[model samples]
Target: MKKIIALLFGALLLLADTEFAEPKPSIDNPRKIVFPITHGDDESINHVLSSANNVMKFYGPEKVMIAIICYSKGIRTLLKKEKKIAARVRSLMTYDVEFIACGNTMRTKNIKKEDLIEGVEIVTAGIVELVERDLKGWIYIRP
Candidate 1:
């Protein structure tokens, strides 16, 4: 009976190890991602939205965090009249995506702080934010 109990215990240990085998890709945690949109065109905005959707699908919303920096002409994509893109932005926000706009651009373009559409945050400098994200190894896409 003693020998039998030892064999069973060893087998249980082996099974436990196999059941909790390490994951592939060897990641310590989910990767970081950032996208900068510098174009106000509808097509370009849609492209960024699509890319973000793909990332969320693969990584799961909670596992990945995305920051979209809008500066220059791209700030128009956050306007209330951008209905199509606005809807897409709303959908992405449900998954915790963040939209950042450049405060300097708003001043230069004479766009009021209140003029930005819902779900957008005004940042001090869009370019600086982009650079900081890049340094942290977040994937950068200009769409």
Candidate 2:
């Protein structure tokens, strides 16, 4: 029984150390990930940003393509007024993370392009962008 238990433990450790599957993320065949932020609260925003950073660290920036889509109240994350959070977003952008804001949300909130952080891209609808990216095989993660 002890031998069997020891073997199982070894197997578990081996599995934990197993490498990622074929096509194995690379600059050309990068893992595509999209993170959607729909809540404006600082906690939620920070959580999502942390999640993205963790992923980037695990995969190495060169092996992954990351996009963050913000809409509704979440649009606040991309606003210049967000200050600290906006700075964090800009820091991630330095590693090539793409940040997108919903145009509809801007119209509803009466926010203008100049109101957002310098590099955020504007999309007509954040949800639609999520859907299209999902269809194109991008992994969608909501943290």
Candidate 3:
């Protein structure tokens, strides 16, 4: 009975480890940063992108893991109809930057996966995603 309980607990621990889904960090990229965007303005989006760009430039692409989580109006940044910022987003993706969209906003705004840009990942809740990343030692940037 003791061995069975230990094995079950181990399995539960392994499962718990997989709860926070995001890009894996390594020794090469020890710094993790999460950008939380709730406003859909172009300036805000660009500012966040610029900050991310600066970080990458400072640390070199291989030394940083950056993720942008968009919720509420910020989802506009990843919309398929959003062409103005697509170029900038695509440019960042080249350096392994991640863009995540909020499913709650998608449901309220009627946005489907096909409605988002090619590489945008959809998470259940953008704020929750931000919290998880923040708890996992990621620096939070509002811009």
Report the error of model 2 at residue 69, Å: 0.1
Give the clash total for candidate 1: 0
Estimated TM-score for each candidate: 0.76, 0.89, 0.78
Models, CA RMSD each: 11.8, 3.2, 14.8
* Per-residue accuracy of model 2 over 57-110 as CA lDDT, tens digit each: 999999999999999999999999889999999999999999999999999999
**Lowest-sum lDDT 10-residue window in model 1:** 18-27
lDDT of 3 by residue, 7-104 (tens): 99999988873332455444554678888878888888888889999978876788789999989998998977888788888899998999999999
User: Over all chains combined, what TM-score does candidate 1 have?
Assistant: 0.76
What are the runs in model 1 whose C-alpha is more than 4 Å off?
1-28
Local error of candidate 2 at residue 33 (angstroms)? 0.1
Question: Which window of 10 residues has the lowest lDDT sum in candidate 2?
Answer: 14-23
Superposition-based RMSD of candidate 2 using all C-alpha atoms, in angstroms: 3.2
After TM-score superposition, the amount by which residue 108's alpha carbon in candidate 2 deviates from its true location, in angstroms, is: 0.5
Ranking by TM-score: 2, 3, 1
Highest TM-score: which candidate?
Answer: 2
Query: Could you tell me the lDDT of residue 28 within candidate 3?
Result: 57
Question: Which pairs of residues have clashing backbones in candidate 1?
Answer: none
